[model samples]
Target chain A: MSDKKISTAVIKRLPRYYRYLGELLENDIVRISSNELSQRMGVTASQIRQDLNNFGGFGQQGYGYNVNHLYKEIAKILGLENHYSVIIIGSGNLGQALANYTDFEKRGFVVKGLFDVNPRLVGISVRGMDVQDMDQLKDFVVENNIDIAILTVPKTKAPAIANDLCEWGIRGIWNFAPVDLQISNFDVVVENVHLSESLMTLSYRIKDSY
Target chain B: MSDKKISTAVIKRLPRYYRYLGELLENDIVRISSNELSQRMGVTASQIRQDLNNFGGFGQQGYGYNVNHLYKEIAKILGLENHYSVIIIGSGNLGQALANYTDFEKRGFVVKGLFDVNPRLVGISVRGMDVQDMDQLKDFVVENNIDIAILTVPKTKAPAIANDLCEWGIRGIWNFAPVDLQISNFDVVVENVHLSESLMTLSYRIKDSY
Candidate 1:
């Protein structure tokens, strides 16, 4: 609609809306009112209407939203149609697990390569891709047009590797490292996955429920 | 603090504050003002004050908050010292990876055992713990007094398995399964780790930045 930038909170919620709409689409649900969608999503109906309105109303005044159409629009906004060439730095347990995760392939994130510093792990194959040596990282990224680097390295090593990845022109980072990465100057986008934080939140919820 | 219950938004942010304070404690930073914490956490100073005030004012007038004191308080609120015994269902790549994740142990979650339906994987060891047969899951959980079950099973099998876990008296579930579990008439807590959702959010952020 307007040229105004979307708020970060709205941006964060778009994926959730996409996921819920996808489920509705799969279940052959053609349309959903804001109230119905909000009930399923555990959010207020007014909030749902406000969020969708930011992206040019996909819903009708009374008939509500077309599930398939809304899902497509959200997917397009999320860049899910753009096939991103991704590489994992650090062939550790988390790295290998993510490499073996088949869900990414269906969502336009292709794991092109996995890199590691350990020589023993270097030549090893993970999910049909050989773990390339760390020395080959820069060249591999440059040649393969890898835009995303998934960092699962140890906390001590994460910062240096993140810097290296950024230097090699990596546009995005999905960092699972314990420490927050320090990338100041670059236009790179980062998504930090702090597993402990999630667990802590869970613990709090469990405690609160009791 | 008033008798009013803390909102879910404030509950979700407690862990992040705990984490930031932990880092400050590690760095021997004794005290931090709300403004300083807000800058590092990317939140407004007033928001930080409001969040902290929900628990009880940890900050003093003019004199900043003590990092160690705040960290301990948050950890207490999160029930981190409860020592929850955890079991992983489905010893696949994700399960094994999480089993080997040593971070959970430090945060009071102990990985007691891993389970799988595959007979071949039953006798196998993951992160030094033997993978148990699916039949042994209930007995193992009961014997160990397990509180949390990590579901890494396939999407199709997730709902049934989650139901089984809940029926067996499991208190909390850290679900990595793609499908959202439908559990009613139970006191169980669930925290879904939707990997695709996270990636989609990242994709949206990247797309928006460009």
Candidate 2:
């Protein structure tokens, strides 16, 4: 890794680049020029060069970028190489879907447990493990050393549940709740996935086309 | 709407503003200063003013903004007032969750149907409607005049299915597949939700913190 600090925008684009490159590797493409990549990604060739340059410029003069090398580099930078114990709170439709998503396990986000306060949901089997009640949350987090929490609870219950997760020493939060979880007090980071916002964006574009 | 083209960054921020304003309305907070809104949203006061100015500035000097008025304006600008008939093109776990999500319907995105290729899933009920087979996709979309298709299919199927959707007159797509659907040939918009990318971002932040 380079000693220079990278902008948040660059960090955000890294995952996208990683995705595109992974596809390229899957197709047996071992090398790609910046221009070729730009066309596929809908990003400018110069922009791609500039972004990769932040991490020591993976391309040679005319040799272009080595696809597998670049993919591995981004994966390492994104910390996908490490294992993280994850728990899904609010075992609703979305929570159950997350638990069933097999790709996360491949990427090292192991779902240790599913949790909910509802009597109907608790004690139900999810991926071979019983959905635990809220009462068992603290012990589960402590014993399993859960690193992240995927919050899919209702907006009304999101904040309080997030507070509990933080207090129990969860390092990161993948919040799917409608509410934004404020985390200024704890040493934790949150990535809020606002699905409704994205839907609105699509609507905006659709309406614009008219 | 302002005659000048708004930047994509400002367009992205509109949904966040809309959400925050909605929360304010729910709390019975009728009025708020740009500074207060900025503090709650974690955006700078000037930035908020600048973003709003693109839509003819909703603020009144010294008196702040009328929360309800601003919220309504943002909603209208985002095209949330219009009804969009939607179809979930995959009866998988993610697809079913999207079908059950009530917020989209509240905002006028009605799920008219869910589609799948699997025989076992085809006749199953979801939200009072039976999951339709892939054979019905064309007729259902055309007959209902579907405006958007929410794709929750696998990546291998995304591009081809998206192509079919475009051919059948889908105005927009909310894709959950990892693959980016290239739709340059048709006049359609897409919003791809990569859950793994988001999870990777959370992992990146956690790794950075250490």
Candidate 3:
């Protein structure tokens, strides 16, 4: 797979395609034309063809995309086959929620520990995993080979925790904190889920309709 | 504001600029050159200038952009001044998290009701609001002037609930369900937060780093 040459835009769209294909597989749909997929995804058929073409043109000339094959290929491309040790920091509602989300576990992100600075949250069990103290984070991350840390902490605590996570050899940071915590000079990737921003987007879109 | 012609790509970047400018305002910084902001945001200076230019160029000649002015303008453009009544359709961990999340309230998205179909979850308290029955959804949404419905429901239930919410005059959907629910020929806008895809993106970026 000559994936290195693919654009970031294409890479982002791969997951959506992967998801849709997964649904198709579940429904026992063997193949789908780009036009059908385009209508379903609200994207152009040509765009789908072009994106798939970037990865050696997975679509057959007239057959469109093979559901099972494309599903597996996308999963492989997105590194879904590789299992990652995950930890949820900040045992708040959102943290516990992510800890409870079985979808992440199904996609090869295994939650090994949940941590928090608050003593009330520490030692509380969520989804069969006990909430550990922040004190245990460094050792737990290093020893267990934790690959990703989900930051659900408040804005004030996020940056320092992200920095420490990077230093502790955590590879990826999935940030839900309101603030942007970009840690450079380390082999760390930060992906933020800014709920506030998403809400603002909703407001922007529906303001005229209202 | 003649914002009708602005591209969706630029609209997506506005929240980020709004947030960055907000931090600048909080720090007592009244002005910023696009170059200075580009360094912090990892955006090109020219791109920042072009994006803000779409909103009538809030920058000053040789003096750079007025942070407070840009912040206010972005807020207005993103429709942040408007208060929106909201309801959560799933009273599980994710739904409860959104209910407890203070940032949504701060941004004027007030959660008016938390609802679920599960018998055990119904009438439970989450952040002062009682989790209501799914049977109450239609009436509550209609009478409460609810502007948005956050669908944190399971995958099987989200699409049907989204359809009902649209029918009940709910203006927007912040979907966390794995499924894509598109309601056309209606006054509804969907903003999805697919945690699984985000995790996949993180995996793709850090596959070699690990």
- The most accurate candidate by lDDT is 2
User: On residues B39-72, what C-alpha lDDT tens digit does candidate 2 reach at each position?
Assistant: 9998899998888877676688988888998888
Model 1 off-target regions past 4 Å?
A1-7, A27-50, A53-64, B1-7, B28-64
**DockQ head-to-head 1 vs 3, winner:** 3
Instruction: Give the residue spans of candidate 3 off by over 4 A.
Output: A1-4, A55-58, A61-64, B1-4, B208-210
lDDT of 1 at A112: 95
Query: What is candidate 2's lDDT per residue for A1-210, written digit by digit as tens?
Result: 677778999999988998999889889999999999999999999999999988676898899999998999889889999999999998977899899999899889999999999999999998898999999999999888999999988999988888888888999999999988888645799999999999999999898888
What DockQ results do all the predictions give, each relative to the true complex?
0.71, 0.83, 0.80
TM-score of chain B of each: 0.92, 0.95, 0.94
lDDT of 3 by residue, B19-59 (tens): 88888988999999989999989999999999988877678
DockQ ranking from best candidate downward: 2, 3, 1
Model 2: per-residue Cα lDDT at residue A147: 93
Instruction: In angstroms, give how far residue B157 of model 3 lies from its true place.
Output: 1.0
**Chain A accuracy of model 3 expressed as TM-score:** 0.95
Which candidate leads the pack in TM-score?
A: 2
TM-score of 2: 0.95
User: Which scores better on TM-score, 1 or 2?
Assistant: 2
